[model samples]
Target: MKLNYSVYLVTDREMAGECNLADIVVAAVSGGVSCVQIREKNLPTRQFVEEARGLVEHLRPLGIPLIVNDRVDVALACDADGVHLGQNDMHIKDARSLLGGQKIIGISAESLADARRAELEGADYIGISPVFATATKTDIAKPLGLGGVRIIRDNVQLPLVGIGGISAANAADVIQHGADGVAVVSAIIAAESPEASARELLQQVTSAKRIV
Candidate 1:
């Protein structure tokens, strides 16, 4: 599968407000989100599995990849396109051994060394996170400003997706700094119009990729 990391949406139920996750995902995809990561940190294993399965069913036909955040078991159970592992999550080698070569594996990197190690461990992509401080995730690391992003981009070969406090306003700068994509949480999901937010973000990402 050719991964287009252009506009990645990382789901947060609380941030989604009144809209159902499925509905939010469909709307985001319709507005041009290239990938969706189901990130339910508070849910129990059973509920997480169910959510992953439902998202997979919804995204599969649309040709969008469903990535289970920090849950290899959920990803395997749902037959999801991939899994996104945080720094403290399962080891990449173990994940690779379990998911095999076909499934996508992404790692969260907070520094250049983390990014380099992820690439060496065979991650399909690296999420360079906390580009700015974010309220959506409480356990965020130090914010990686655009300069940090450029430094990591210069050091890693894997596709870079900038996360944390990302919105349409800063999406272009993120990409211009060498992120192949931007992973947003609250910006789209919490917006009154998820689809329009996604569209605007996608437009910014597309325009940035072209110029950079």
Candidate 2:
């Protein structure tokens, strides 16, 4: 599957506020989110699987890929398009052994070394995190800034998605620095109108790419 990492949406049930997750996803996708990741860390395995399955049912028809974050079992159970792995979540080799070559596998990388290692380990893409310090995730590494993005971009060959505190205002700068895309959580999910937020973000990314 050819992935368009532009405007990647990582779901946060709590951060989603009053809007339902499915509704938020649909709105975001409608507004041009290229990828969707289910990242509920507190849910039970069975519940998570069910949620993934439900999302798959909705997203599959739209031709958008659904990635289950940090749960190989959930991905397998739902036959999701992929599984995104955090540095501590699962070994890339182990994940590949289970998912095989067809499934998309994304790894989070906070440093140039981690980015290079992820590419060597066969990750389909590397999610470069904490581009700016973010309140969304507590375990994030120190902010990488645009210079860090440039360093990682120079070192890695895979597609780069900048995460952490990325918003419409700063998204273009992230892409300008070398990210192929931007992975967002609260920027879209927490907005009063998720669709409008996503559309604005997509515009920013595409516009930046043109300039680059």
Question: What lDDT score belongs to each candidate, Candidate 1 first?
Answer: 0.93, 0.95
Best by TM-score: 2
Backbone N/Cα/C clashes per model: 0, 0
| Candidate 1 error regions (>4 Å) | none
Mind sharing the TM-score for model 1? 0.98
User: Which pairs of residues clash in candidate 1, taking residues 3 or more apart in a chain or in different chains?
Assistant: none
- Listing every candidate in turn, what is its Cα RMSD in Å to the true structure after a full C-alpha superposition? 0.8, 0.7
lDDT string, candidate 1, 2-45, tens digits: 68999999998987777898899899999999999999979999
